[model samples]
Target: MSSPLKRSLSTTGRSISPPPLQRKIPRLTEHVSSTREPSVDQLRIFSWNVNGVGPLLQKQLSFSADSLSPLRTFLKRHHWPQFLCLQEVKISSKDTATQRRLQAAANQSAAGDEPSYTIEFSLPRDKYNATGFGGKVHGVATLIRDDFGSRLRATRRPDWDLEGRVLVHELDMGLVVINGYWVNGTSNPYRDPETGQVVGTRHDHKLRFHQWMLDEALRLERSGLHVILIGDMNIARARIDGHPNLRTSPVQHVKNRADFNAKFFTYENGLSAVDVFRHKHGNRQKYTYHPRGRNWGESCDRVDLIVVSRSLVDPLDAVAETDILDNALDRGHSDHVPLWVALDMSIFSAKAAQSGSD
Candidate 1:
């Protein structure tokens, strides 16, 4: 079955026509910024599922030329310092126009100021094309501030990177930030002929992806690098992570819930990861995604997450706070809200030194 979301461009090799610019929403006019500047010792990282960058760019055009683009506006307001991981960008790397638009937006700054960010992208190609959404399938992207971008030594896992699901950047600080867009489980399923069980669904693929991430996390940890994994994981860990009213098959939901729990709670070699937001907020009923239809009765889930290794949690918790950016006014941008954490890098001063020496 095809996805419910529409593609921005057609598969017939036609150029995309820009959507009509609508009047700027009142919320867009508000000027907001973080309470503090991101010093060399601190880094503010953010992640969001854009749904589709092509459509988002079109929306940005509707605003006044002097105003900041939607993405930049969000970054500035939240005071995102150095790193941004965007999932479901929905544009191929071959699409130079869209890629350039992202670059321009990342570099965009106040008048007479220089651009701040340099970007890297992972695009899906060939058999790895997870999204069958015509020629306009989605991908993931990582944008680093120019200052930090210069320190990026290399990208690990070339084979995985080609799937456009993961981008692991190896920083000179011996830190690795992985931006991932895990596969959304298949919607349709078939029953087994002999056992009479539902099988061959997308959830199977999602399970494999989760296992791969677990392995990757361990490998990175063993290499002695501080790791930050963030993106739209597309899995709700428990009943609290998702609205209870959403319709789902009992077996599928149960399996998915267990898979999510294992991914975060299970330990390998005595090491496990923690969900930053959940750790900070506890049992907060906040959600990062509000599915189609504005009806409150519909199901919503906190699938977008920021997970960090246990080693970094202590330092992060010392000086940082995490929250779900669920502004109702910004709901028009995408179904998924942005999730972020602000950390004073100074807390990591000791750990940074230790990692550097390794």
Candidate 2:
């Protein structure tokens, strides 16, 4: 965190101006014992699809340049959730006007308070490798609070080979986060000679992305890292209420269209048992994606997801909460809402019985 800003005289003694959004994370005074269960109270996680956050902020905050403040403000206002992660991010950091605009959003979010994230980015080395949504960079990032980032030795999946997507952060909590953005498959089509019919495109590129992500998950699993693969999967886990063939629908009707579902997200790729914010509380959330204007007209599905290692499968099953962030527009100011969970480490960690078993 940066130095606190000076206070101005207001009708009240408190300063009227909020402090600048801190780009740097704070230093931790202590570390959790690896042998003991982590202080769960100290751990909070958040994830979102900001839909190319730069433009979103620019529109809302009057920022001409892409700024970090709106992003900062969002995090702070949301009580500064401790373990922050995001998808669909922008790569540019040069626009000072926009930069100041971002800072302003951050200040508003913080309300002159402190923000916990120590922001970090893993950008494309070659500009050509980058992907964009509506002319803005489409990437991912992790905003580990100071303690989390410092304690965890960060490593990323290879940047180039990826479909402009990345995740899998090694947590000091003996866990690894499998963060990702599955490929989006969409292309226009024209009626052709073979069948004399027209068609649209599906996830041909994403199939590759999912395979790569699964391979990364398996590599971590092989290295003995406890893993939790979470983020936008770009696939539905089960058959929707109405589908032609249900599980086997995509086999023939959709030539190159991918299921992106758990059954097929990655076959030779690596993962299998994805523990979606399961419907344990009631039903897992449905409909991960939504076009702004087509709400009432389109059928919905669950694409954003959480897949834990079989090692933690049963445990994650015990404390998971997967749902579309209803406050998507308000709290998130994002298109993709957050899907969150609560795990009872007591069911899986070493201290479960030791703390009380003793």
Off by over 4 Å in 2: 1-42, 55-73, 92-113, 124-135, 159-163, 187-202, 241-259, 262-270, 279-285, 295-299, 315-322, 327-333, 344-358
Model 1: colliding residue pairs: 41-345, 42-345, 90-138, 186-202
Which pairs clash in the backbone of model 2?
65-98, 68-102, 69-102, 69-103, 69-106, 73-106, 279-284, 287-301
After the best TM-score superposition of candidate 2, give how far the Cα of residue 168 lies from its true spot, in angstroms. 2.5
Per-model TM values vs. the true structure: 0.80, 0.64
For residues 144-213, what per-residue lDDT tens digits would candidate 1 score against the true structure? Answer: 8776677789875446444577888887665778888876654454234345466665566567677788
List candidate 1 segments past 4 Å from native.
Answer: 1-40, 58-65, 113-115, 187-199, 244-250, 267-271, 296-298, 314-319, 352-358
Residue 240: error of model 2 in Å? 3.0
Q: How accurate is candidate 2 locally (lDDT)?
A: 0.47
